[model samples]
Target: LHSYTKYNTWDTILSWINSIASSNPSLVSKQVIGNTFEGRPMTLLKLGKSSGTTKPSIFLDCGIHAREWISPAFCQWFVKEALETYGSDSQMTSLLDQMDVYVLPVINIDGYEYSHTTNRMWRKTRSKLSGSSCLGADPNRNFDAGWCTVGASSNPCSETFCGSTPESEIEVKHVADFIRKNKSSIKAYLTIHSYSQLLLFPYSYSYNLAADHSELMSVAQGASAALTSLYGTRYTSGPGASTIYLAAGGSDDWAYDLGVKYSYTFELRDTGYHGFLLPESQIKPTCEETMLAVKYIAAHVVFSQ
Candidate 1:
């Protein structure tokens, strides 16, 4: 129950979610928090046991950047697998029984659609700014963690533009609001990205180490090891600034600021040989392998709690 090739379109992704909700009425519920810049619905899928509010919760999202198709694909695949195996698989069933998973696939719907139609390498939203010709803002850089201070640009045309203000992008604002509403229950926050084999934790805004740096590194190491066990793929685990380039105002840092104990940014699939132009053929294996890491992290979070 994995989809790697299709669902790149907003309609297709929404249709898939709707179909799942229809098929599994008791297990699946969709929440429309708001709309994207292009009027695309910002949807969140709530999965796991239907029991009341005592269970822990996890937040997972992908497609903050439009050109990163692999990000959203893995998210859809994760949701599909979670629902399909919840009853039969002991691990999944146990986790679901004690925890709720909230997944937002295709966060930047307008930019994602725009990438398919006009630009193959588009990386921002499509919001129009007054007195500026730039089309969009980098949703990843629109978060409130050291926003636009470093590793981010002030110019609207830059790829890493932090937007006029924190949470300026509608997509980011919606996600921030959702996370804020569930802050107390959310134990871990994960946002999927692409073009690098990395499992990065905060503080992306600076080279300084996090207060729980040891725990963060430990979880990232475990997740990376799990991913490697599945397909022999190697993933470097560390802080975002050390492992990759420093990028202020990223979702992972913002999640950490919100007191989520475990916050991670996963950069999936092949390295920069293809960059954002990852082939459709690599989708299935990528999603499959990443699932091992995700499940490992989820289990660790549950046990630690």
Candidate 2:
């Protein structure tokens, strides 16, 4: 039930997280960053070969949109591979030994549970709105970066509704606070989403290129190439607004503005044939190829710094 091939419910994922952390005490440990809207603990799994002193790390999160099940599956698969390949896989070994990887398997836990039981297409947090019948805001569009601008909606019933204010969703605030506190040691920020094979960088809120735009572009191209090498899954890489659409208030853009220079957003798998309902059969291959791209980006962060 908790295998990488299939999407697990919140309960199963919680159990899996507990088992993994308990079994691999040295390689992995759980930190409760904060609780979700429905009070489910937002557990962050910090993975590294423990050292007495602090080390630079990369922060990665998935399932910002509840219906994107494959996103969370990748996070779980990444942890499994990191633990299983240590000492044998040189790149992974060096990655874990050199720096830590903070993985939040599912950020929107309450909405995720609602998606599983109530609505298969639900795409926001499950928090209730003050004066409206609608519930939840798009967590991706709930960040403080150009919040509610351009691509986001102000209507509470809209799918892309930006909250009343930045970090209006408690889940978004918790993650934002964590990143703000660790900005110095965090080298890169990676947020996973689905239904589009794209790798994007900062300034999704506007058309302006980032200060490190050239380097970010080069790294993204390399990562995309690496991903294509495995299973021939191609990905287009560029700035979010220009490449895809004018999406504002995204985590990647916010993190980039916050000084995490190597920030990126990975839109995985098919371009939209399966959409959010990506099948379990594609999980292994999807994760395998995505791992190549992620490693490529992480390696750049490790060596280039």
TM-score per prediction, in order, is 0.97, 0.99
RMSD of each: 1.5, 0.7
Encode model 2's per-residue lDDT on 223-304: one tens digit a residue.
9999999888889999998999998889999999899999999999888899899999999999999999999999999997
What is the alpha-carbon lDDT of model 1 when measured against the actual structure?
Answer: 0.89
lDDT of 1 at 17: 82
Candidate 1 lDDT tens digits, 129-153: 9989987999999999999998999
Model 1, stretches more than 4 Å misplaced? 1-4
- Listed per model in order, the count of residue pairs whose N, CA or C atoms clash below 3 Å is 0, 0
- Stretches of candidate 2 exceeding 4 Å from the true structure: none
For each candidate, the alpha-carbon lDDT, in order, equals 0.89, 0.94
